[model samples]
Each structure stands twice: as C-alpha cells, then as structure tokens.
Target: MSSLPITREQILRVAELSRIALTEEEIEQYARELTHFVDMLSVLDTIDKDGVPPTVTLTFDPIAQRDDKLEPSLPRDEALAMGPVTSDGGFAVPKILGGEG
Candidate 1:
C-alpha cells in the first residue's frame, strides 16, 4: 500500500473533535480504509483534463419555479374552520415529547 496521507493519531483527533466514540478496532479499521481510499483516488491525478470545461451539474435545475402571480384561493377563516383541530391561526397538534407524549 502507498504511504497513507492520514494517520491513526489524526483519525483519533477527528473523532474526539466530532464527539464520536470509536473503539480501538474501529479506529484501526478506519485508518486502513482511509489509507486505501486516498491511494485509490491518487489515480485521478493521471487523467489529462486540459481545456476540459468544468462540469456544473449532471442535470438542469430539477425544481422549476413559476412566476409569482395573484390567483384565486380559499379564504383563511374557511380553511381554518375545515380542520378538526385549529389553533390561533394554524392546526393544533398534540404535544410530542420523545416522539410521543
């Protein structure tokens, strides 16, 4: 394997900074995986990308926004009255604590 740009110490430091708890085995495994990834990605340096236009995106704007215009819509009071539970101006939902209360 090529010399690894990352070290176990660096990995440990990152984990500590991120507040992540990893076991010794996990740290060793990640070190090896990261080293391999760096070595593999180094092959990209050999590519001849001269004068190649940088790719902006693989697809055009996926979400299209239409021009804003005034349109007929339901009245506020009627819409609120349709709901079984309504608050001051919106829907009233049960209190959720730890996903359930």
Candidate 2:
C-alpha cells in the first residue's frame, strides 16, 4: 500500500542497529514487508476481544514439583578423593585466569 510507512532510511537504520548489511534490493524488500506486518498488527488491534480471557498456559496438566527431603550424601573425604587434586577438604581445579583472588 502507498500509505504503508517504512522508509529506506529507516530500514537502513534498523539494519545498522541489528549489525546486518543489506543490499539495495533486500532493503526495499524488508521495508515493504515490515510495513505490511505493522499494518496487519494495527488491523488486529481494532478487533473486539473483551470477552476473551488472557491465557497463562494452554496445557491441562499441572506442573510437577519434586518433594524436598533430607537424604544422606557422600562423605566429604570420599567425594574429595575422586578429584584430581584436593586441598583443605575441597576439590582443586587448574587456575583459569591470572589472578590470586
């Protein structure tokens, strides 16, 4: 439509913001497509949806949650023994960065 409002400059600005390089033809295509999409969305806004309820989820099943219960875990020494290096009752991994913190 002639009234559909996306300019070449606006399209270029959007492409710059998105870090994309669009050719002249692609830019024209996107400008037309985006304008059409926005027009469609505006048309949708005119529809009456007061009777419709907002949906959180469409699924019938309730979300399952695991029961929290205290259980015996592996002993500190036994767990630490599996590690390549154990210092001060903990696992020691190789230093990743040059810093002593």
Predicted structure with the largest lDDT when compared to the true one: 2
The window of 10 residues in a row where model 1 has the poorest summed lDDT is 56-65
- In order of appearance, the predictions have TM-scores of 0.49, 0.44
Candidate 2 regions off by >4 Å? 1-3, 50-57, 64-101
Q: Candidate 2 lDDT, tens digit per residue, 30-94? A: 99998988877786677799889989878788977678988899999988888998799988777
- What CA RMSD would you report for each candidate? 9.0, 9.9
Clashes of each: 0, 0
Per-residue lDDT tens digits for candidate 1, residues 1-101, read 47646788988998999889999999998888888888998887789989999987676668677779988799888889889999788888887866762
The TM-score of candidate 2 is 0.44
lDDT of each: 0.84, 0.86
